[model samples]
Target: MALGAHRIPPGKAWQDPAVVFAPSVLRLMERVTEEPHPDYVGLLSGHGASRPGRVELSARGRIFVGERRYPKGSPSPEPETFMTTAELAQKFRANSEGILAHECVEAILEALQGLEKVGDIRGLMRLL
Candidate 1:
C-alpha cells in the first residue's frame, strides 16, 4: 500500500470495531501522527494476504496468535505480546543497524521509482 493511505475518519475512534490491536501495535499507533500504512492495518485486521503466522482478530476485539480459538462468549485468551522497547531496540541494532544507511537509500530509490511509474513528476521532484 502507498504510504499514509489509510485514514481514521475525523472524530472516529481509531480502533476498528471488528479487530483489536496487540498492545505493542497500539503503542506504535499512539506514537504516530498520521494514519498507519495499509499493510499494518491488513495485518492487524487479519486479512488473509497479510495475516502473520496464526494471528487472528475476532469481531469482538479478541486477539489470537498461534493458539486455539475459544468458543463464542467464552473468556478470551491473552493476546501475544511483542518485544519490549529495549528488546526491540537491541534486536534492531543487532539485525539492522549495519545496513541502515543502505536500506534508507534503497527505500528512497524505490519510492522515487514508484512516483515515476505513476507519472507523479511533482512528487518525484520534491524527493530529489
Candidate 2:
C-alpha cells in the first residue's frame, strides 16, 4: 500500500520493511515539526489513508517499551500489543513493519511529543 509517495512493502517481515517506509515516515515527522498539534493519530494514520491506524501506533509503542526494557537486539521478550505486525499488514493491506524499527519508533515518539525536530533525514537514514 502507498502512503503519500512511499510504498509499504507487503508480506515482508518486520525486520526488513523499514527501508521502504522510513523515508515517508521521516517526511511526515518533518512536517509534524512545523505543526502545533501533536497529531500522532494523524501521522500514523497516514493523514487518513485507512492503514497504519492507532493500532500501529500502539504496536510501535510496544516496541519502544520493549527496547527500553532490554538492550537493542538482545532477544527481549516480545512486547504485547492489540495486534501483531503481520496481522496488521494483512488487515490493512500494507506492511506495518516499517514503523516498528527502533529508530523509527523513537523518531515517531519524539515527533509525537514535539520533543525533537526530525529535519535531518540523512541522519535518520544513517541510523536505520
Candidate 3:
C-alpha cells in the first residue's frame, strides 16, 4: 500500500504522449525513475496503492527507478561510413538514447504534476 502520496486517478501522463510515445523505440529505454503513482489509493477502501514512478533526467542522463540501462554504441563492422566510425556509432547511439530518455523523464514529470494539481484518486477518476 502506498503511503504519503497522491491517489490520483488514471488518464493522461500529464505530458504530451506524442513527445514521449515512441512505441518503436520505447523498448529501448528504461522505466520510470521514481515510485510510480506515489499517491495511488484504491477507491473502495481508500487504501493508497503503490506510488507511480518518479522519473528524472539530468545532464548526466536518464534515470529509471527500477529498470535496466540500455547502453548505446556501434560495432566496428568494417567502419561502414565516413560518419559511422566506431566512436561515431557509439556517440550517435548515446545521443539517441539520451534524447529518448530525456523525453520520458519529461513526460513522467508532467504526469506527476497533473496528479499533484488534481488531488485524490477521486479527482483522477474525472480524467476517465
Q: What is the lDDT of residue 54 in candidate 1?
A: 32
- The order by descending lDDT is 1, 2, 3
What is the C-alpha local distance difference test score of candidate 2? 0.41
| TM-score, model 1 to reference | 0.19
- Clashing pairs in model 1? none
Please give each candidate's TM-score: 0.19, 0.17, 0.16
| Candidate 2 Cα outliers beyond 4 Å, as residue runs | 1-94, 98-103, 108-116
Estimate, for each residue in 1-128, the C-alpha lDDT of model 2 and write its tens digit: 23322444434532455754576666755543222234555653553322221212223346221112222223334344345544543543334345466556555444534426666666655544
**lDDT score for residue 102 of model 3:** 56
Error of 1 at 74 (Å): 23
Count of steric clashes across candidates, in order: 0, 0, 18
Mark the regions of model 3 whose C-alpha exceeds 4 Å error after superposition. Answer: 1-28, 31-34, 42-54, 61-128
Which is better, 1 or 3, measured by TM-score? 1
Query: What local lDDT does model 1 show for residue 117?
Result: 68
